[model samples]
Target: MHERLSFFVKRDSALHHLNPLTKIVLALSIILVSIFSPWYWTSHGLLLVVIVPLVFIGKVANEYFTSALRLILPAAGFIFFMQAFFQPIGQTVIFNFWFLDITQESLLFAFRIATRITVMISAFTLFLLTTHPSELMSDLTRRGLPPQFAYVIISTLQILPQMQAKAQTIIAAQRSRGLDTESTFFKRIGSVVPLVSPLVFGSLVEVEERAIAIEARGFTSKKAKTSLYEISDRSSDKFIRWGLVILVIISIVLKLWLS
Candidate 1:
């Protein structure tokens, strides 16, 4: 599972060389545009055109699509069912079944919501695949974030692999003890409860141990903290950062004028 998370494109592309802060800002801007724009075709078309090129730039377009489908399809299904049956919109009803009505507006609304979520997820996936977690944390620290915050972010990334290994070990151990996770739906879920308890408990203990270790190492001292990696603001990164800002302004103006 962690291997899937490591589904990144390793390349010496311009997107890879960009500072994480630039990517984060640009991704967030795209997300904002998708969310705040009117749930209509014009707004979504703009986002689609803008983000499609990022796939080529990041060189993880295939993985990005897979990741988006893994998350977005199920979410879209839920939205479709809910909006179609429960919150039907529009003056004209297309279908009526018992107490539920499906309207054209509801369908369009669901599609809009699903597309918006897909775009946002794709943006984040591109960011994750293109930017290293360590570099992102370092960028955050350099941008006036607390050192402890950066440490937490970096630790989370490091812990994910450990957690995956521990989970697999726990599952195998439980299976040896006759707890079958491949059993019926409820039974499988029930098996997971016991299998996961030890992992969660172990993580809690590990966190405490890490906290103590940090304290022992004087991590909370008043002295400035030094990082192994330093974040430098390159000219190209600055140019892209400013360019994204301009694009965001243009997007907002277009939205206001068109809407």
Candidate 2:
């Protein structure tokens, strides 16, 4: 779960050379475009033509493929399947599973939904893969994003993996003491309390210490903050950001017109 959340793959590539903010704009633009596209197949086409190519351009194709297989596919697949069975718009029935019927209209709708979801996730996955968390925060801070927001974002990213590790440790300890996570559904439901309680309380215990640590480091200092690592924005990065802004505008216009 955390692996999917913090899926940064460091590589020296064209995508990595772009400013963090540029990548963010690009990601947001793609997400908006996919969601508001006039054509049914627009999102699917973007996923295949834009996102797949971006994985190679970023030189993190291997990691992107891994994430798509492990995380993206499963999530999008479930939603697609659910919508196909339950959506109420279809006239032509494709199949029937007891009370649930899959219809042609529902299948098309689900296809669009799944494709949009893929485009959204793939765009952000590429952005995170190329840009470091600190670099992203520093760039945003330079552009008037609150310093506290930066601290919060970076701190959350840093702590998530540790929290995941702690959860795994607790699960392992419980499993050793005869907790069966793979048993029946009711058993798994019953097991949630034991698994979550420890992780929740343990994380809570660290909150005070984390607050103190941030305060000691002058987290709220009014002086202009400095970045240890410099990320230079080139003319090309500016051009790309402007292009993405235009694309976002176009997407919104199309959405309104369609509605």
Candidate 3:
């Protein structure tokens, strides 16, 4: 399970073959477009058209949808309640209750916001599920991010598994001590706090040790750093990067012309 979580899905799909940098840039572009474009269904529909196919191609549709739903549902609920209560009164009210009014415009706006968030969430989830965390760190470092920043990103990824293992160990040790995790909500919460306190302290110490180790290994003084794995830049990568740049330019031009 640890091995599965750490590695990328080894598929022979075109997206899997693209350089991680290209994928990151594309994902960011889509996210930016989704956020800045008009909060309308058309803009969100276009984003979905692009992302849904990719999710299917990557064979992570279920995971992507699950992650997206977890974010979208709460967001949708909040938008619904807020708009239903706080939206400005308009000439065309859809519903009137005692002292509240829900206008058609507000309903549309709420729908637009919820759809936009869904598109953004789905776009990011697809990107994260497809790209390996290590590859993302390497790409960032190659793109001139400080080695320290890359180390921080990589360390964060490494820490998740370590923390999980440590938590399991602590839970077992506590169980041996007759601590009950299946007690009332407050009791379970209280019991786990002390059990996990050492893990939190240990993580801080580990981080300090890592920082010292990195500095001692000449990470800061080195003029150049090399990666163990190199992401090959092929003709296809160049073509795709250029294509995306052209697409962004076209989108901007269209937006201006239409406006």
Candidate 4:
């Protein structure tokens, strides 16, 4: 499962036991507050004081931080640097890079955006790590989310690894035939046909078979479906969800007032 795109980890903690809907609400609320709140410190506070602490509270700190370092930090850093260098000219220049300048105002703006992104992705990362995809899908299905949507979501997550493996196989085969990734741009361009045709069409061809298989399982049946595993929700889950919802509403109100 480690090689799969789904990031769920097996953990025995209060967070892991929370109903999938509760966790989704929690993650969404944190993301909304960090992005839309009026206070300058709110995003940073949520990241440092809320999401980071929840990592340990959920007992998945190691996996969460691994995802942060491997995926979130690089993306946030790229956005930060791009904003810092390319933003409109301002008075106080802190650093210069040839034709580009980093000013205090742009630095502050970039930092704010980066912190918001960090909070948003971290919230999702924690939720994904603690909650299984099947549980999330099942709960959403129970809540009247379309069954097709659930199938698409779970299948999309699982398909990534298969696509990647197919790409690697194509690359290896091309390499054996003298295709070079490190070669000139034109050569790489030449290799793309060999590399991508099979990868793309291979996936496309399998879709029909997968659809047939799903239909065979009565995917579109009107009868009520049963879950193989039972998910439990408790009073605490309800309390946390309500509290988060109220907090999100307050944040939106504050943003409106400030504007």
The segments of candidate 3 whose C-alpha lies over 4 angstroms from its true place after superposition are 1-7, 69-86, 89-91, 95-101, 178-193, 215-218, 221-223, 242-259
Give the worst 10-residue stretch by lDDT in candidate 2: 1-10
RMSD over all Cα atoms, model 1: 3.2
**Candidate 3 — which pairs collide?**
none
Kindly list the per-residue Cα lDDT of model 2 for residues 11-105, writing each as its tens digit.
88988888999999989999988877787788988998999998888999989999999989998999999999889887899898888999989
Model 1 misses residue 161 by how many Å? 2.9
lDDT tens readout by residue for model 4, 1-259: 3255777889899889899999999999999998789988899999889998889999998898888899999999999999999998688999998989999999999999998988889999999899998889998898899999988888888888878888988899889988887779998888888899999999999989998998999998988888887789899889999999999999999999989
lDDT of each: 0.77, 0.87, 0.74, 0.90
Off by over 4 Å in 1: 1-7, 179-193, 230-232, 246-259
> What TM-score fits each model?
0.82, 0.85, 0.78, 0.91
Model 3 residue 93 lDDT score: 84
* Index of the highest-TM-score prediction: 4
- Candidates 1 and 3 compared by lDDT, better number: 1
**How far in Å is the alpha carbon of 108 misplaced in model 2?**
1.6
Count the clashes in each prediction: 0, 0, 0, 0
